[model samples]
Target: MSVFVTVLSLSSLATILAALVSLADYHLNDYGVCTININGGTRTVDVNGGSSILSSLAKHKIFIPSACGGKATCGLCKVTMVDTISPVLPTEEPYLTAKEIEGGVRLACQVKVKRDLEILIPGEFLTVSQYQAKVEKITKLTYDIKKFRLRLLDPAQMEFKAGQYVQVDSKLYGAVREEVSRAYSISSAPSDRKAIELVVRLVPGGICTTFLHEHVKVGDKLTLAGPFGEFYLREGADHLIFIAGGSGLAPIRPMILDILKRKLDKKMTFFFGAVSRKDLFYVDYFRDLEARYPNFTYIPALSGAKPEDEWDGEEGLITEVVARNISDPEGKQAYLCGSPGMIDAALGTLREIGIGAEHIYYDKF
Candidate 1:
């Protein structure tokens, strides 16, 4: 009984000390308001110091694409520090390349704002706005993939290019105690300004994806921010080659629709890779488009088709199918979206087939 009492007393003392230290640090590290200079003084925001650049900018309504919230994991919230050169944290080393580091690019989530900062933000990021949206519909596209249709409520409209992406915010649910943000490409066409569609594949332990797939329901309110990424179509290429797999189809779908709606003269060939027929979605949609539009063609390739699949389409890796189909790369530009491994392999294959590196544009998730 005496030993138990003594241990309790010690634990109380430790807790008191920890609280005192936290209080002291809170008071001592209270940096006053600091100014954030953006894009050579194109804009500036004054924010309280001692918070991360990511959260600080977010508080001021400047949204950056961060799939991992502000946890320094996604490495998507990168901003170029123009005047201040800070040490890169160990968490940021794996995401940044030597060239990026040399260019003073730092993960905004990892950088604490203690003083005034001068940074370069992309022109597109300046246009992004937060929105209150309602989950209008949810459609099961595959065993692990679902399509979420979000209708903007607060601001009834969003202007974005066909291939841009948006960041969806998730509430804490079940075992997840922290809110998270994830980036998903908009699958709906730009013509539909009132709503957007996101194609999400359930990652085994993904925080945002799991929340979206399981906890989110139709009519539930959600907060999202948007119109990020530079994966949209570029003009001047008469022949466009699109290659994607899984949820990578999100952005390409809109691009294809936009092109067809505009009645563009460009010839489009889409190569969709999947493990089997079960993994494929929007096949009929693209096939209908192909039948109506002579300039468009849809090719779904199965790399690992099972006997039960009864698949008789193109059988091989996506890269191999692309190589087999395309003989001439002249006046052709390629847009690819998929896993990093698939993108890297496609890059090599496209290069071998005489596609210029400048003509190959990709968005890797």
Candidate 2:
């Protein structure tokens, strides 16, 4: 009976100690409130001082472009710190250049808010806002690619450039217990203020992509923030060259439509690359546009055409086709959106064709 009593007493004592320890730890670690001074005190926000700067700013409706959901992988949430809070983390090294580090630029997602901070945010990010949107429709563009049209609910309007992207936040669904956010370029024209379209390709085991591809449905509500990135069309160029592959066509499509709708005095030639006819999308759309617009041309190239595919388009790589078509790169600006490999190869090819590096703009995924 004494032994049983002693065990019970000890267990009760341990439980009390554990609870006290947890309470003490919470009090000790509680930073209470902290202030974030933005852009030299142009704006200030008071937040609870335990979360990341990204989340803290987000709580105040100040959205930073973070594609990896605070994982520090996307490296898009960069802000300049006026005062140093901590040393640069190992995770931020890959994203920061020497100049950026020297200028006190740090990843907002990785920087914890332990105390008051002064940071500089670009003026463009000041206009970014979060919106509650509904998945209005889903269109299958290819086997792995689908277009998601999201209609804004609260704000009902989003003013964004032709090539800017938005970050879609995913919720806990099925096996995906942790929420995530991924960036997708807007495929709709900027004039379409009520809705924005995102073209997403399945990335095997990608967290957001898998959730979007498998679990998301029409009328499903989602939280998204945006109008990020600077991959838009620039004026002053009479001739434009647009190169895209796979889902890269998202931004390019909007730029093309926007330009045509505005009736810009520009000649556009779009070179779309795919593996085969199955990979090609918007062929008829661009073909119809080409037929209607005398200044527009659509060229679809197949790199790995098969016998059964019955392909008779440009039977070569995109770069090869581009080289064969364009004889003069003078007064022309090139816009490319694709994988990093394709961007690098296209850069080399464009440079070889006498296009200056400054005349080329690309958004490499």
Candidate 3:
């Protein structure tokens, strides 16, 4: 009788939770339609309120760079609201700094547009689009890294700067589970223009990486959105050093290709660091790049090489190789993309090698 009562209580609790979830989905997230005023009434949008301002704009085809896909982990989708908001959500608290809160900046994903709002986002976001695409090819680049070529099926192709990244919406694996979109840097050159390619390294149990590696196949249709990021090359840097590891190579490759194609005569060095020989990829491609440009060099370093590897290049930590290669970092700017630890190490190594904080630029993965 006690077990039966406990079972009944559990069932009742679940039913109540389901009902509340349904209610919130209906009432808190369904403000049929509303309007948004932007830049002092210079622009207006008739959008649905109740979903996050981020998602509502996205539903209408505005692309914001959110690494967490609205879970609010990346803190990329920040918007300034001059008008009132519902309240600060718990999910946004960690990502929000104190000054940001004081300035009326909120995580777009966490804020529901319950009423008409005036918000501030990048102008580039106004141009980003949502596309229906088909996976055309999937080829392994390294043991852990795979290259994916996606062809847009709907409004075919995209116009974007070389260093931007797009968010890939994950499809269900087996059960009827909803998946979040994951962002990755665009690897294909802008010259390709018609198709998109991404370099994805297999992450052990990562939700999106595992799905892309194990379940997705060629010809599978996927919904993707936007070329978003501010990691592109800024003018006036006469000398540039690009550093990357693992899948961080994606954005830097495209940026280099873009610079090369434009016939820009700039001194540049690309340092790619990996763990072993198998971990290294893109050697021949970068070799070709070096042949075409006199002022460019692609240096690949393996930190842990085996006896059979027969390697004689730089050894030890990647930061050590960086410090040895670039003797005078005083005048140059650097771009780093990798794990947070690696970025921190590189930034410290760069500064130790006499690079100013102002001369270093980074996009940490």
lDDT of 1 by residue, 240-280 (tens): 99999999999999999999999999999999999988999
The residue ranges of model 3 lying beyond 4 angstroms of the native Cα positions read 1-32, 84-87
Where model 1 places Cα greater than 4 Å from the true spot, the runs are 1-27
In order, the Cα lDDT scores of the candidates are 0.93, 0.92, 0.84
Q: Which has the higher TM-score value, candidate number 2 or candidate number 3?
A: 2
What TM-score should be assigned to candidate 2? Answer: 0.90
Q: Say which prediction, candidate 1 or candidate 3, comes out ahead on TM-score.
A: 1
Q: What range of 10 consecutive residues in model 3 has the weakest lDDT sum?
A: 356-365
**Candidates sorted on lDDT, descending:** 1, 2, 3
- For every candidate in turn, the CA RMSD to the true structure comes to 4.9, 7.1, 3.9
The sequence of per-residue lDDT tens digits that candidate 3 reaches over residues 1-365 is 99999999999999999999989889776677788776677567888666887788777677777888788788889888897565678888887798888778898888887778888877777878888889999999998899899998777979888888899999878663878888988899988867899999988878888888888899998888888888878786778899888888999998898888888878899998998888888888899989979989988898898878888877777888888888986558888888888899999998888878877776654
Q: Which ten residues in a row have the lowest lDDT in candidate 2?
A: 356-365
